[model samples]
Target: MAKRKWLRGLALLLLVALLVVGGMYLYGSSSGTVPPATVDFAKLSPEQEKTLYARGEQVFRAGDCAACHSSPQTGAELAGGVPMVTPMGTLYGTNISPSKQHGIGNWTADDLYRAIASGVAPSRKLLYPAMPYTSYHQVTRGDVDALWVWLMKQPAVEVANRANAMQFPFDVRPAVALWNAVERPAAKPFDASTDALSRGKYLVDVMGHCAECHSPRTLTFALDKSRYLEGSIIEGAYAPAITPAALSGRGWTRDDLVRFFRTGLSPQGVMTFRMASVLDHSTSHMPEEDLRAMAAYLTQDQAMPGPKPKAPQGEVNVKGEAIYVGLCAGCHGVQGQGQPQSSVPLNTNTTAMFPTPINLIRVTREGLQERDLPHGGRMQSMPGFADKLSDQDMADLVNYLRQTWGGQPGDVTPAQVADLVKTIEHGDQ
Candidate 1:
């Protein structure tokens, strides 16, 4: 009698657990409130179509869609082969071109809206958070309608999406519903109400999605809202803090911010790492007024303390100074004043000023390629020193830069550099 009662209790417990799991899956698999589509596609006149096409192009540029979706080999804007690395695994951007076989050509505007705003694609496919739907949760439906018209009009590419390389547990696509139930925000439209500041917030937070990289992530890989835009290490590089105070402390002005977006160069520094793609695809193409508004939002339209040389933080290392003179002083002067359009000035450069030395180390070891920037800006090639420098040598050189120009302590060690090297190499893989 006792054994039969125990088995019955065990079965009941299993049934209860199954019921809870099933209920959670049902709730998570469903999308939150998606706003109604603003335009009637069938009834639009020629003039309306023209207006939507222009607005959609603007929306696409603002979203920086090409940076991820464009083909690195062919430079096809929506062919979608770029790889995004994360802690869980690598996810390739999907083909968004207008091909019915491989792209979204058959998707109605409402389908596009559901995908963008609620993170639910057709057939209830849940997109990985790498798509930035969290930040885009508040995007306006009107902008999406315009984007749909423009996207559908573009030439279709027949490229199929590359399979994701997610490790076990994450490889199960349906399991994403659990993450969604816990972390995803409800979709809502942003109110941009004709105010510059409001519009700037809309552009930066909703469309630009800057916080997706700049903000630190929780253990679950969701963005930590408490420290929004305070800086974080991602893909082996540090995305620096862009809070108004942080920007002002690093000698950024509103005009300089506009200049950086417009040209990818300012006294602050040149765009590097993932931001290089951003410059090529998005900011450089943005309008002057929009750029101004972004800058205004970043700086809160406040008067800022301009670039000034930082005082040396500690005793300079003799070996580090020698390395700088021997290798670096040719382009960057002995005093760190860079040549015109060739290299950025180091004294006022913000890389070393960051809380972590990861970017400085990464850039030094990897180097930057020569490139023609948009809007009359250009930078010569900077050579990588990976083969030439030992771990100790890199630590010393980075320490020297931090002390002399960054107003930071010379505290990096060879062991720390070796660990960072592993991280950099892994990210490259």
Candidate 2:
């Protein structure tokens, strides 16, 4: 009798669990299915079509379509097998080439638009934010159409879509839909009144997706609007605050931004890691007009400015000075004056002068690596000392640099270094 009762109890437990799961799935709904686009390149006049393709190509570069979609293997082009390491799990980029079977060849213009601007797929499935569709949603219709044209023209590859490695609950697609349903309404829209400011807003907020990297996130992983673009830590590098308040003390100007975009170097220092990729693949190739527009938008406080960094208090570390003399001074110079050919110069550099020393710690620990340009030029990568240095050593080293070069205090602690090391080991900042 006890055995029979036990079996009945097990069956009841299983049924209850299923009901709970069913409830969750039913509640987690995505957006409606997107219809196929009606616009066709075949319908346009030859000159008009040519202009679109050209314009689309410009959008392609500005969007840096190749950065995410391009396969790592040489000659793969935009065949799409790049793996993005996120806090959730490893997600691979999908084949976005024009393959009817493997890529977006079958997707309609409306389908593409909705997916880019709404984060919804034709199947009514919510694309993971790992695809940047939340940011992409701000992209304009003309730019989306242009991107569609350019993508369709590229040669399609037969590469298969690699499955994402998300943990369960998160691995469930409906959960992503739930986020979309709750989060979409809150994203601020571009509402600038002036034409120049409006144009700049579109480029920075929509096409450039600047906040995608620079902004900090809430526990839900949504970009924290309260601290938008004030700066954030990224895996393998620091995404600095570009806010006027952050840049003001550093002597950054509109012309300085233009020059940095064009050369991947500011008067302060060289762009490194992903920023370097952005410059090489997108901004460097952008028309000077658009670059100026982007600068204008950033200058005009698209997001309300954060407080400027206060000068830190303290003398340079004695141990950190010894480490720099032995290791870093070979390149950055005895006085932290970096070389002309080095990736970053110490003096007037943005990394050191930032309020927090997380960036300096990150670069020193993990190092920086920029992708080679389409034209075959590549910047030198910073070598990581994680293998060689202790947590206390890093804290001391960074604290010293910030104190001396930035005229800031030595504030980084060994405990923080230990935490950063733990985070970086798990593939995040």
Candidate 3:
């Protein structure tokens, strides 16, 4: 009996040691998160050359590469180091510069294509989803090929890739591989239909990558297919739905979209600094025809889906409402009218009116940077409350806001709150 007990204790120690070693190995493996390997660009003929460069320019616009890669604030064009915050962690956009050591100078065209389309490094390690490989998977082979050619010709710089500040469990690269294996496919093709709108759909679905921001995601970081283009909370800002129902209230016209895409401003109002920043660097450069097609495609009824069914509410929800009144009503107002000129109205605002629970949770936690409001003269900004409020408080506030003013009634689960909290806490948003 004594010998058996001793053996069991030794086995337990071994198990614990194995777990620790496994964890470190997984962590160290992530250090090989380099871009894909280089391709033999000299293999392409002259005719293939012009086409590749042309296609590269198009993909560049659609993917919004310049938006994050170029440091406009620092006047460092394409010497990347932009910070992208998400609900999971803060990702610093790295130098795609051709410098051999600091950037992807050693990468070939094939390496660029693989990274653009699949989000895998040349070393085959899975990239964090924050890089938007899930949406980029839709990019066509031709487009990927073109993008690679274009990126290869760009001037090289020696800026090092920044270390990602993601939290544990999520910081593990093997876990990211698991996520990609389970939630995403190895590849996705553009939808083929004869309609012009369908071609537009192909661009947005694949190359344009609109779904990266527009599509809502589940707690596991998988796209919520049922709610595609239904909008999601990104960083502290809510990427509002492009649906007719969502846009209908905003009174957006096709012309309005055109103007917004052209200059990041329209008669209806501005798209805000974050969106403006996106458009200034990317969308504005897109061909007018493609922009028009994108606008038409987004405005279509077929693109946007309906909201999900509400769950049965229990007595706990009733308790949550009481909590909202005691906490939120002071600033948001009792009638949800908001503090006029000081707070945004929760009843009719585009974000508040949306049925999804994401916006509410996001707003309560991160709060809005009022200065970034698009139509500053017309709208007031609310501060982020992440530090002041608990995850439950945020859920209750969101629940109350959604049920009472958002035109949806569903119980906010603690699990959802916890997941979002983790994302935000980890530096995602």
Candidate 4:
């Protein structure tokens, strides 16, 4: 009698568990109420089509869609082969061109809205959060409509999507429903009518989605709202804090912010890392007025101190100074005043001021590529020194930079550099 009762209890527990999981899957995989299409597709006149196409192009630039969706090899704007490396695994951007076989040519505006706003694709396919639908949850429906018209008009590229390399349970696409139920924010429309500040917030938070990288992630890899824009380490380098206070402390001014966004060059530094793609695809092409609004919103109209050299924090390392003079002083002046339009000055650069020395170390070892920036700004090639410097030498050089100009303690060690190298190599792979 006892054994029979125990078996019955076990069966009842299993049933209850199954019911709970089923409810979660149903709720999580379901799409939210999609907003009505802003324009009637069949009734559009030529003038309306033109207006929407222009607006859609603007929306695409602001959203930086090409940064991830463009082909690295062919430079096709929507062919979609860029690889995004994350802790869970690598995910390639999907083909978003107009090919009916491989792209969204047949998708209705409502389908795009569902994907962008609610993270649900057709046939109840759940997109991984790498798509940034969380930040796009509040995007306006009108913008999506305009984007759809423009996207469909572009020449179709017949490229199929690359398969994802997610590991273990994450490979099970349906399991993403649980993550959605727990962490996904509800889709809502943005209210940009309040003021310029509101418009700026819309551009930065909703359209630009800056916080997706700048903000720290929770253990579940969701953006931690508690530390919004406070900086985070991603893709093996630090995405520095961009809060108003952090910006002001780093000697950033509103004017400089606009200049950087428009030209990819400023006294602060040249754009590097993932931001290089951003400058090429998005900010350089943005309207001046929109750039100003983004800058003003970031600075909150606060009086900025601008760029100033930091005082030396400690005794300089002799070996580090020798390395700088031998290889660096020719381009960057001995006093750290960089050549105009070529090298960036070290004294005012913010890389060393960051809490971690990973960026400094990474850039030093790998160097930067020569490129022409927008608005006639250009930088010469910086050759990588990976084979030239030892781990100890790197630590000493970084320590010297931090102490002399970053106002940071010379505390970096060889062991730390070795560990950070592993991270850098993994990101490169």
Candidate 5:
């Protein structure tokens, strides 16, 4: 009886797998109704071409592509050697350089556009969503063409591609096609509106893709609309909620936003982790008018009212202090000041001031990977400790750090700790 039951269960699982695979095969094979050759760059005028080139440069910075594609030690922009971690496994960014043998030297403008907009390669394999087509889809076609031109103009190097570290079921590319068919939204133009707020909304949603971090996602990696802009885990960092309610803890003002975007620092503290990388490579290079608009938009948005509850000054208990001493003191020092050579100062980290503890916990769990900085700078890498500490330990350690070093007494419940762990493990809040 037991053998019969096991066989039946196994059969059911196989059947479901077959159905999913078959659906993906059909979807990917048939749904690509358009040809790559349809990309018509001929329609662009000389002036339009120049504008597209400029916008493409902006998009490259905005997306922080160089940070991934470039090697930090060699200072090779877009030459590619960064390894990205995912639940499926680790995948390395490929050389987008125009090296004839190893990179996209032979790829046409259409190939580039399809790769960006549809996550489809020239050979029709679906790229992993880790490539962030969800955000790239908002990029205009003209901009993509210009980017292609710019990329081609760069010095090409023949750096070999690294093998992917994905698990068995996920190592396969066809599965992503299935995932896309079920979960991916088709690229569409930003909805036009008369008001500045409405326009800002479109930019943030489609072009900026702010929600990619600020919002949570389901187990299948679909955005959870219920808690839009409520913050989530991405790439080992907790992207905090940028909603009106969450910004109160940061004490952000209109001017602060503009300054932070322009210089990667605010009155609260300096940007670190992914946010700092974004500013140094992307936002700071954007037009001043756009920066002002983004700032104005954030200021107008409402935040949750009232003072956020934090650990009172010097109220960290002995237990919390012990956790920091035992685990953190070696790297962070006795006073929570990080090693200036390799670590960020915990006392003044912008991440320590977030309303929630996800960012703090996430960074502690997963050490950072070094990436490129604009103007020939490089950020230091840190190790992640997701598997090392328990929820109580994390809460205690973080509470101690925030109070002792971060000025604010940010209290984190065990429940919050558990929730953040779950979010990081699942790759979303």
Candidate 6:
């Protein structure tokens, strides 16, 4: 009787495995649909073409193309060697530069548009969702065409394409099809009725793809649109909530936001995280009118209820306070006050006040450096203490900063530090 029961259980397991494989096979074999581009280049005059090309450049910047496509040190503009970390695996950016040998030089305008709108490559492979095609799909056809033109015009480098290091089933392109069929929303026609609102919606949802970093994902890795930009952690940085409810007591005005979008600075602090990258590559280049439209749309009808400062300063370890005075005080200022001349401000900074602890932990361990901010000019840098400070010391130090400087109460643990270390080093699976 025992022998018979074992045989039945083994048979059941095999049957289940076969069913899953068969379902995947069916999903993978099917080809996804691609829509046609909206703008008709054939009918346009030479002057119109020039205008479209310029418009396309703005759109590309708005999409923050350089953040991923251009490598940090060695890669050419849009040559694509940056590696993007996703839950499934690591994905390397491709050479979209127009090099006929290794880049998209051979790709026609239609192919480019199809890739952007449908995430379907000309080679018939299904591109990953990490490229934000779901959001790009909603972009206007004219803008998409303009983007294509601009991309094709860039100097093509002979950089080789890098394969994604995704796990078993995810490594397969067809698997993305099944994920898309369920997760990807149908592209809606541009609604021009709301004027600035429609433009804002398109810019935020498509061009900006703000939700890509700010919002959390579902079990299958789809953006949880219900929560919208309520904020989530991305690659170890705290992307704090930007909604009205979240911004209520923060005291950041629309003017502050508009200025930040252009200059990457605010009264609270400088754009220190991935946001700094966005401002450098994208928002700062946008037209003033478009930027205002985006601001109006983002803030909507929400009223700013002035400042609501927290309670009295909390206690921090003496050692942590000493570390702050010795290393951090000169720049960040004592008791979290930023140096008057520097862009760095601490008393009302978002990094310390945010409920999430990743940014603080990261800045403490890795430190922040001023990189290329072509539009915003060069900002200051912070030297890292990864080697100098232990996990406990760093935690105590951060806790001290939050309490004394930020008027926020929080505690940090060594174990949390360990997890953050892992996250910063290995990235998510």
User: TM-scores across all candidates?
Assistant: 0.94, 0.84, 0.65, 0.94, 0.72, 0.88
Model 5: weakest 10-residue lDDT segment is 30-39
Q: Over the full model, what C-alpha lDDT does candidate 5 score relative to the true structure? A: 0.67
Model 6: per-residue Cα lDDT over 1-429, one tens digit each: 999999998997776566556535644443334456665766978887788889889988888887778766684658887788877788888888888887889887777766777777777667788888877777666777888878877777887877779875567565566676777765543555567767777777788988888787778888888989888877767788877667665666667777778888767567766787688778888987777777767778577654344554666668878988888888877756576545476666767777756788788777778664545355677788889889888887877777765566757787888887887776652
lDDT per residue as tens, model 2, 275-375: 76677668888888888888877787434322233354576699888888887888778876666655556766767787777668767877766544333
Ranking by lDDT: 1, 4, 6, 2, 5, 3
Clashes of each: 0, 4, 17, 0, 14, 1
Off by over 4 Å in 1: 1-24, 27-29
Candidate 6 error regions (>4 Å): 1-37, 305-309, 316-318, 340-343, 372-376
Q: After superposition, which runs of candidate 3 have C-alpha atoms over 4 Å from their true positions?
A: 1-40, 43-48, 72-77, 191-194, 301-429
Better of 5 and 6 by lDDT: 6
Model 3 scores a TM of 0.65
- What TM-score does candidate 5 get on C-alpha atoms? 0.72
User: Residues 1-429, candidate 5, lDDT per residue (tens digit)?
Assistant: 999999998997786687557746755552333234323566867776677667677767655676567765575777787777766778787888989887889888878877876778776667787777776666556556668867876788778877788886677666577677777667543445566576455456655667776788888877788998888767656677776645755556666676667765444444565576567656778776666666556556654232223334676657778876776778767765666445555554557666566777877787667754443444466677777778887888788767765555747877889977786676532
Q: What lDDT score belongs to each candidate, Candidate 1 first?
A: 0.89, 0.72, 0.64, 0.88, 0.67, 0.74
- Of 1 and 5, which scores higher on lDDT? 1
For candidate 5, the per-residue lDDT at 136 reads 62
Runs of candidate 2 exceeding 4 Å displacement: 1-42, 75-77, 186-194, 301-312, 366-382
**Residue lDDT tens for model 3, 74-106:** 645567777787656667777877778877777
lDDT, candidate 4, at 77: 86
Judge candidate 5 at residue 375 and give its lDDT: 39
